[model samples]
Target: MAATDTIFALASGAGRAAVAVMRLSGPASGPILAGIAGGLPPPRRASLRRLRDAEGATLDRALVLWFPGPGSYTGEDGAELHLHGGPAVVAAVASALAALGARPAEPGEFTRRAFLNGQLDLTAAEGIADLIAAETEAQRRQALRQADGALARLHDEWAGRLARLLAHQEAAIEFAEDGLPTDLDARARAGAAALRSEITAHLADGRKGERLREGLLVAILGAPNAGKSSLLNALAGREAAIVSARAGTTRDVVEVRLVLGGVPVTLADTAGLREAADEIEQEGIRRARRRAEEADLVLAVFAADVAPDAVTLDWVARGAVPVASKVDLAPAPAAIGGTAPLPVSALTGAGLDALRARLAEEAARLAGSGDAALLTRPRHRAALSETVAWLEEAESAPLPELASEALRAALRALGRLTGRVGVEDLLDIVFRDFCIGK
Candidate 1:
């Protein structure tokens, strides 16, 4: 949408409530609000006003606040109308706004305007979206950190260093006849190498930020009737998966969400893993193996009353947490697959707390506490990866000119990450997922 167009949107959650906030931004925001509210309220101070249509028909009385240009959220004129939240009141006020030259805002248009106006960078805009969608305490804190520009500050610092290095490299080429330090090129390459090493170390974080942002996946795998579904239900505190005595009862994966150690987790109860005569059962087993392979963590369950099957034992050997289920029926084996199995009786609610604590510890280990500044999206990782590649090229270039070009390209990549440059195409992709009026 054009920035010249006056945009307005319902800023609060939709539906009946005590109050609804309607936001407006653009050059005409002040005038349109003035006309509707019988003149603009003192800038930044809330004033109750009678909102009316162009024909002077009363719409709704609203608490209005005006924000003058260049100092507002979008770095332009802005206004907010706090109105009675009945649907009729909201509709009437919306009609009045449209009649006065304001158009409905697209999803995330407000935040997009903020980015375009230099009020906040692309990373911070993304952080705002993440904060809105955050489901757990960890997610909220991480999003808040990102929205507050922690990632942007770190990236900008790196970009500034790289820019200085590029300038030095270019000086070496441009002033070679004047003898502008023979070691300039060498120092630039050394700096590039140092920056590349730091970025590479950042990349080796085991995807903790990404895991915490998107939540971790834990898959439960076991033989038929091995109490896999029972364990899942117990952990979820609800019957999320079907449990039955019949073999191959759960023929598909069932998933439930949980918060472990403040990190969001998706726990999947997969089909039983075993050879089967039926086609459906074989397919189920195949899916169980695939889920385990894809999961961030795997819970390999064995029945305490039955001998550990070779398939489950193999999974246990492959680093899956061994769990001896149905402990109410029989004592757990001293060890399974060279590791002690966690004994649990889902029916009796015995050892469930310990199991939860163990899972929480694992979850925290896999996804670190959200206090540190971390890359929260795949695009962030991709941009940094591209930057690292260019930095490496700069360090190894055969000529100073080539190294300078590589460093420039690296700066462009970093620019894309923060929307400082070359980001017209990326704006849509970045903001499309945000809610309207963000």
Candidate 2:
């Protein structure tokens, strides 16, 4: 990462394609592009050019782009070479770049430089990563909002207020020493309290953003022969789990991912919950209980034709969705576990549409569609929590000087979230997960 050394990397996905994009950024980007592409093109314009090696041998005809300094993605001289997507062509161009004194970029170096040059903040940078990794439309929308500076704007607003408070606290300390009457101290404390309340409210978003980012986990639990596996297969629209008439057929958890209400859900069909005599069945039951406890939502199933087991009934009492499976076999009870069961027949495909709709509704409730600027990472939560604590200390501090110090600490925490300040230690961590050439 020598600032003076030009770096180049394949910005496009690695595979044989029609064209491969080679991105270059650094002080020598223009010179390196000229050396290999025969000469630089008009700034920000792409032109057809013959790429040649130092030996003056033609490598390939390609599209060459030259983006001159102070206006490019990294705010430095940069260029991109769209070359034929062939291993030999890529290798020859890479060799030529090295010969021209340009090295390969490290992971996230491009975006890291963008952040260093103030193109975007840390939260927005993370949003870029999320956007690239998004698997659903809802996820893409949320990531796009964050990348468009939604979270950054919110954090910057709070940071501005915190800075003002610190300034007022300092002013109050100076004015008191000079025996001047001023309400600066009271104003600073009041402002800190208000900001603290706002941050607290933001932190209480039910972790919808995080849940959307990571996806939701729903576990199906019930006694043996309760049709949990059948329900899972029906919901997945595939034979995802082996079915059996015998009890304890599924000895482990079977999981499948599906989108419900635009939220990705990992639906787990677990072993029946019961006191088992077999050792393997006992382990399966243990895992089933553990999965149920850890799940974001639970589907406690009971057969319409059989008596509901108390173990699963307890789960239903604790807010699990009660489902009456095999509805074709017998009529569902008026109520089970204090609520009306969702009558469904997995074998006959009866009531499955309603069941899916119900699951989608629950998924939306558990993990929101994330229309608001929500915190998507645990790091955001931790930083905001720390900021809130510091604000509380600032509010209660007896001395204006101490209060100012607390405000400074709070500002540092907020700055870490948006990479405005105090983020040198986090750069590696933040960018390490990024793909090379980002």
Residue-wise lDDT of candidate 1 within 77-186, one digit each (tens)?
99999999998898899988999999999999999999889899999999999999999998899999999999999887888778778877876786675655578899
Models 1 onward score TM values of 0.94, 0.93
C-alpha RMSD (angstroms) for model 1:
6.8
TM-score of 1: 0.94
For model 1, the superposed segments whose C-alpha errors exceed 4 Å read 179-181, 421-438
Model 1: lDDT equals 0.89
Task: Please report how far candidate 1 places residue 244 from its true position, in Å.
Answer: 1.2
Whole-model lDDT, model 2 = 0.89
What value does the lDDT take at residue 30 in candidate 2? 86
Model 2 ranges off by over 4 Å: 421-438
Candidate 2 is scored at a TM of 0.93
Query: What are the candidates' C-alpha RMSDs?
Result: 6.8, 6.7
**Residue 287 deviation, candidate 2, in Å?**
1.8
